[model samples]
Target: MSRASPAERDERLDPVRWHRPTRGTTLRLISVAVLLLTAAAVLWFKPATCTPLLTAPGPTASSTGKAAPQSSTQNQARDQTEGKPAARAIPSGSVGVPIRLADPTALSVVRPGNRVDLLRLESDKDRTTPVANAALVLEVTGADDPVLGGLLLALAPEEAKQAIATTGRGFAIVIRPS
Candidate 1:
């Protein structure tokens, strides 16, 4: 029945200087470290080319069965090589087509010259199908009116036809890299 000396007391009694990690705690720490390292490695290393999840269709023959003209850049390069006075290059393949967006907020995001993919909401479940692939965003009208708040797009003739036909259905725009 006497108090023990400080030096004779067990170190476990000194709560501040002791740490005992449970198995679950150690496993959790290891798992977190592994996850962090894996994330870092994935961020640091990337593939040379990123593959597109869905392929977009380019301008094809128009509804009239006439094939579309080549893009300006290609024509300019050809003209330069052929030694013809670079004819005033014209944008011929795509034409402006108007389509309303189901979501009004979507109108603010699109701008002229931005490449976009058009999708149609197919069912009540929100499933979608790509209607126009890699079409150029020609213009966006900043109107909140449900029917008027939409975008004007420069799409191939076939895509224009598809877009015109798909207007009644729900439309969603997906912006793409130029």
Candidate 2:
């Protein structure tokens, strides 16, 4: 081995260089980075090993009686009213009733299947009193007062018992023109 020279190749001690790190090489690089982060947190919280690219199957009402496939983006924001389509906005002996809106900007054009009336108000101001005439807006919640909002309503059963006995004495949501 007599031909290596440029001053022994720049004072070589190279075994692919990186060496000053020890405490047993930082405990074997922190045990291979905690065993690759506990195997990526057990495959990222296990229990879901596949099979779900559009799973709609759990509503068996008795395994095979049939009836489960309504999703045209929920009838494309329904509201044909007399043409009856937003999946009958809760009409099957209805009784949902949540209502709390007294005007939180009319729950931003209330949706989920329009058709409403609700009124009742009168808490120290302009009188109004109808409490459920049309009612069917099946869900529009979001009210910590970013302009008031909350109205589940599906009524009928004596208008869900007069809108659940006048839901805490306050109401107001008129939208009925469609």
TM-scores for every candidate against the unseen true structure: 0.45, 0.32
Question: RMSD in angstroms, all models?
Answer: 18.1, 13.4
Q: Which residues of candidate 1, in runs, are more than 4 Å off?
A: 1-90, 143-147
lDDT of 1 by residue, 1-178 (tens): 9988777876445647756999999999999999999999999998975423222234556669987643445544565699542332213676778777767677766666678899987755658878898876655665445455677777788887877776345788888976
Q: How much does candidate 1 score in TM-score?
A: 0.45
Q: What is the C-alpha lDDT of each candidate?
A: 0.68, 0.67
Reference-based lDDT, residue 106, model 1: 74
Instruction: List, residue by residue over 36-108, the lDDT tens digit for candidate 2.
Output: 9999999899684443322232442433777664333434344344443343335556767777765577776
How many residue pairs clash (N, CA or C atoms closer than 3 angstroms) in each of the candidate models, in the order given?
0, 2
Q: Can you list the residue pairs that collide in candidate 2?
A: 104-147, 104-148
